[model samples]
Target: MSNPNTPKEDDKVNALIEKCTPILKKMTFSSFMGYCGGLTAQKVGRGMAIVIGLAFFGLQGLAYNGLISVDWKKVQDSAVSAIDTNNDGTIDADDLKTYWSKLKTIMSNNLPDASGFSLGFFYGLTH
Candidate 1:
């Protein structure tokens, strides 16, 4: 047997549906995909930040406890050697300029969503 209150409940449901119909119609597939992509990027960025932060802190703790020793001079020498592309035994302004140019070219060619990913990465790091 149908309840006596069914008509009133049906009226309320119909009114709610009518109110939501416009909002549903405005949501397109592209909008949905864009939102999903952005959300995925943000989540991935956050995860990367967490892993990097943890690794940094872990290394710091280990270094502080003297569990591992780092030869800073050796490290600096290695870095200088790596950056000294001209092999002139020195990292001069010209070397830095060349390095910067190469880095810019590589980044521009490789990273398509660089701006968005960097923004999301910084946001994740800060927040």
Candidate 2:
């Protein structure tokens, strides 16, 4: 039997819900987007970090075992080429502008709430 003086779990939950209900009701669309986008970014970021970490370790293990060979020079050259827009042999402001434009295009094409998400994404990354 439960203690008569103890608070029930359902009562605690109900109280918590009551406390949050007004704040939730007061949320606006932009604020809602910001909250959801930030939450999504945090979750996705953690997931991506884990996946990338596993891939990096897996690739290293394969290379160490002679099952795969990574051409470091090719990889470096491709990475440079990707960011060195205008082929100036240097990554500068113009390359960054190009990268931003490409990112914007991708965001618009893929996301229905790109602007709000972008704002929240930056906020999320910083916080």
TM-scores vs. true structure, each candidate = 0.42, 0.48
After superposition, which runs of candidate 1 have C-alpha atoms over 4 Å from their true positions?
1-20, 69-127
Model 1 Cα lDDT, one tens digit per residue, 27-121: 55434433454566578878999998897788778989999977657867997898898989789998978965664455335445544443443
RMSD of each: 10.0, 6.6
Task: Assess candidate 1 and give its TM-score to the true structure.
Answer: 0.42
Kindly give the stretch of ten consecutive residues in candidate 2 with the minimal lDDT sum: 103-112
Q: Write the per-residue lDDT of candidate 2 for residues 78-116, one digit (tens) a residue.
A: 878887989987788999788767755664564556675
Estimate candidate 1's alpha-carbon lDDT, on a 0 to 1 scale. 0.65
Relative to the true structure, candidate 2 reaches a TM of 0.48
lDDT of each: 0.65, 0.72
